[model samples]
Target: MWGGDRLDNYVEQLRKERGLNQEEFAKAIRVSRQTVSAIENGKYNPSLDLAFIISDFFGKTIEEIFIYKGGADK
Candidate 1:
């Protein structure tokens, strides 16, 4: 059951843990709040550059934020 949580759920968890509202997090990541909402709702997969920016902002690796459900080998 690894990497099973929905993207929205994971983002919500991270937002709460980091004490960031959508507007604040979006500002930090230089995206619109609606964009953050879309990402949190699993409606979008950010570009690699944006992904890296987000991971760096949170001090986490991309793998930590975006899970690969089928395992590393896919």
Candidate 2:
């Protein structure tokens, strides 16, 4: 699971389920493929606008996409 509950794997899964490659999905969401790749690799934290775009693209809420693991849980 990429990034665990941080949403990277969720995005990857969603992208695959939609039969979208990184380039295609990135174009659909108006972001560079590198940005999408970075997000999936957990090398980037998406801006609020980008996050919303991703959520909307996947038909999921922000919380459903990005889950924050609190220190207490660790």
Candidate 3:
């Protein structure tokens, strides 16, 4: 479920840090701008493949970008 409210990401921050807009970042990651927007807004959970792609594009690990805040529930 991508944790809904429990999921957090640094996509927007990283994209801005790299001076790339949503469209540019989406293109770099081979995804639609809307998809990027969804991920940035925390309304969508990326597939494992997409996660790898994004992480690779930013030279980071999936855990570095997507954080699960529901760990406290366990």
Top candidate (TM-score): 3
- Listed per model in order, the count of residue pairs whose N, CA or C atoms clash below 3 Å is 0, 0, 0
Clashing pairs in 2: none
Tens digit per residue, CA lDDT, model 3, 1-74: 64378779999999999999999999888889999999999999898899899999999999999998875545
Q: By TM-score, highest first, what's the ranking?
A: 3, 2, 1
> In candidate 1, which residue pairs clash?
none
Model 2 Cα shift for residue 74 (angstroms)? 15
- The models' CA-based lDDT, in order, is 0.75, 0.80, 0.90
As a whole number from 0 to 100, the lDDT of residue 68 in candidate 1 is 52
Quick one: how many clashes does candidate 3 have? 0
**TM-score of candidate 2 versus the correct structure, residues matched by position:** 0.81
Q: 1-74, model 1: which lDDT tens digit per residue?
A: 22223432266578879999999999988899998887777777677798798888878888888765543434
Top candidate (lDDT): 3
After superposing all C-alphas onto the true structure, candidate 2 shows an RMSD in angstroms of 4.1
TM-score of 3: 0.88
Q: How do the predictions measure up, each by TM-score?
A: 0.77, 0.81, 0.88
